[model samples]
Target: MHQNNLSDLHRFIDRPTSTWSGRNDGAGAAHRRVHQAVTSLGQGAPDSADAVFIGFASDEGVRRNGGRQGAADGPAALRSALGQLALAQGRNSLRHTDLALLDAGDVVVSSDLEEGQKKLAAAVRASVDAGVLPVVLGGGHEVAFGTYTGVADSRTRKTAGSATSQQPGRLGILNLDAHFDVRRAEQPTSGTPFYQALTRERAADTSCRYTVLGISEANNTQELFDTAHELGADYVVDEDCGVLNQQALLSTVREFVASVDIIYLTLDLDVLPASIAPGVSAPAGYGVPLEIINVVLKEVAASGKLAAFDVAELNPSFDSDGRTAQTAARLIHTVLTYYTPLSSAAPSLR
Candidate 1:
């Protein structure tokens, strides 16, 4: 096994001052401009470029729940963590095959539920239109609706008599979470984005598919599972999949994405065991490991079908010495490295 060192961990935590101005014009500005334009237009910006990283921190429900109270700060904290991965150079320095990437800032979400979702949808749509793939950070898993809505709207425009002419293929969701997130709107908690996505009036026309991985049997409701199955979603439980062994799990994920035109990877941090990711909205005793989660993300990135992504449910209030943020950052760095071109090596960790 590759033993991790304190120096290595520390190297990925320090942020650089050179890239903070937002006018670098290299990959960073080219990345931020799309979100700036979209936010300016009050619409979700289309990702017209090769790849773009966008972050969204929706803290609406944090006030009501003690567990997720600090999720609003997750995006910024994660970005800070990712800066330590040394991504200033071309692709050759990366662990995974390099690809182009940029960091688009967070989307603005209001306190009102409906209005916030609409705003998020518009922002996401704008990002997709710019020809850039969006990698969104989260406020909660509920933001999945907005992220998916934007992607679905983009696919709707590209439909060629039932086929999409996009880089990733037909848009679908690969959600890694402890809960199914299939709760209905009767309660409207943060646990219902997938259900809303499947049951929404226009969902059928959008042709979006969902694959839920790492579900905890203790947390799921039978009715929700039945509904997900009815919607044609592939639900894999933690018990059945054997938590950290991602090879078999990734094979199943690959099968689910085989027919899709595009894939959105959504990670609810609660999918990790409570020991690893304790600062989530819902902490579970059993879940995937940190390193294994990285492998899964690497596979998704390698598949080249990744369209957009979101990592949600991080509550800093429960974090110990920012370990949760640190982990989240490493995951985000892996993602950024996955998309950056191999010719440009990531900056060496300081």
Candidate 2:
């Protein structure tokens, strides 16, 4: 069934307004301005552009947590924060000459697990068909299934009519999180996306190779590690790496990116130390510092082959004075800057 009403899905902000300077001043000005801009621009017409950033905040699983009900508001909050940073960083000044962006709104999911996945898949497929790179923001890690499904669908279409056409190259997943998130989808929660992606036929056919970084020993079940090995994932445990600084992490990520055709980045905020991102679902005691995360993101963006990005598990309700949101906003800004490419002087990571 066609979910969104196409007529209602027109551009959010058709013409730029003079009053609407897409700037993120310190005040909530930028946030409100972007909210209005996107709200006015609305959803894009189907298959509409060269590149797009789709934000999905899955709140279905969050209902299980008592104080985590506000995860649904994550996409908006992250966008607001991103808007402020974009304004501060003058992101509008760096829009790619050839690439246009559309903020495809969140997917409408039903209570039933299968139904929700189906809805999410359809939304992702629509974005792909339109030739948009969907940058998904999530309510939980389970959102990966929907995001990956979108990319996989595109690959499937390109190979569908050809008898001898080889499958598309592997999707390099740079998953920066505290836990492996390889739990089986017995019930389809935040811990299950990677497992489902590896185990399912559609996703497996895409030959998705995962690079799981910032993993805490405490969170890794033997089964998760065993499954990761069985599935051929480059599992990097934080302890085994032994005192890795920011530059070292960037190098490692660069090596991983070189090994794949397209990159899909998924960041679970819990990967950061609780002191930095206390708003996440499961804050690790000792996690990657915020600076290291930024460097990794910069390198990933500079790679120039980033297919999509997802920032997930941010619980604004738990954020203290929006510190976590601010941090995430900065990272998003860095990503945009890395992808923006100012001049010929800019180093190419392609």
Candidate 3:
């Protein structure tokens, strides 16, 4: 909350003065890009917004998992790429409807991964409690654990002592990734976030549904598959998410959405082909196509159940020509364009 001291904002490098600058068409606000519409959080601004961007600038999880480490720089890179893109101009756009966007900057994790996760949870919880969608940019898939904790804690507080106290609504996680990310690690790592999430929910006796799309069979072992099954999680393998199976792939996503009370969508770039998304902790040998991924993203956004969103594993060290960042930005852009806030579409526990 260092609203005045920019450099100490998050214990890392302060947010750049204008990390989100782009073209000026000079045709007025309609012609403005994303950079034009976004405001920083904690600047004597309104308490609410349509969506807020929070960066988790930490790579400790990846380092623990024995993966490449540059993802700590992912948040800034994503902002740079997203800034230049034009805001969607149709009636459905958040900006077109006068809703606001804000950037809260990053939660820097210098060493203690667990402490970093706790800090992230607090930031995300604040946004959700304010009825704003928290669009988190990741340092690794470990971002999933913190994001889930924040959203889950918010729900718990919202339902406490209410008529629905006996039944906190089901929270469904739809992960678009190449790995199941449910490995049982001694400590939290890039590969253990989902496992942490599921265990936490179960310990609290809450309803949680975990589903994964674009899982690469070769990347995940049989033990991981067994663990998913044992935990009542569902997943669609990468081979089944190909262009030839577009209808089925979308159907699966829609069904999962319909079955859950709310959705937290997390996209891991490694779900796409290595050639398409080389900037990841682990590049996919054979991955889902971006077209199919985008279609599924649109479906989830339109479902009116999405409560939060995050993009993981964008290691710029391996990216070519900024392709991965651009792609991740495009997906974030798509979700913002079509997402129906739960407040408008449902009971408004989000």
Output the better candidate (1/2) by TM-score: 2
What does candidate 2's lDDT look like per residue over 1-350, in tens digits?
A: 01223233223212221122345434553333332333212434333343345555566664532225556667767876765433233444432322234565665444654465655666556654443445666767767777766666665344433356476655677888888877664477677777777777444465667888888888788898887788777866665433455456667787886776666788888888889898876777888777777777777766755656778888888886887887887776667556622111335543
Q: Candidate 1 residues 1-350, lDDT tens each?
A: 01111111112111211132223244543243222222211123233334444555666654433345667667766655554444344555545323334544555454665565665666566555554556677777767887777776664335412433332235668888888877655544477777777776244555567887788888877887787777777778877656445667767866875667567788888888888788877888888677667766776665655656788988777786777777887786667556532112323321
The top-ranked prediction according to lDDT is 3
How many steric overlaps are in each model, in order?
45, 10, 0
Off by over 4 Å in 2: 1-51, 62-69, 87-100, 155-165, 201-206, 239-244, 340-346
**Which is better, 2 or 3, measured by lDDT?**
3
**Which portions of model 3 miss their true places by more than 4 Å?**
1-19, 46-48, 90-99, 156-165, 346-350
Residue runs of model 1 more than 4 Å from their true location after superposition: 1-50, 61-67, 88-101, 155-169, 201-203, 243-245, 340-350
Worst 10-residue lDDT window for candidate 1 reads 1-10
Tens digit of per-residue lDDT, candidate 3, span 1-350: 10121222243323423446888887666686888768875453444467878898888999999999999989989999988888656643332234467788888887789988887887777766666778999889889898888888875334532374577778999999989888998999999999899988889888889999988889899999999998898999899988999988777876897887778899999999988888888999899999998878877876767778999999998886999999999988887766677645522212
What ranking emerges by lDDT with the best candidate at the front? 3, 2, 1
lDDT score, candidate 3: 0.80
> For model 2, how many clashes?
10
What's the lDDT for candidate 2? 0.62
Model 2, 127: alpha-carbon shift in Å? 2.8
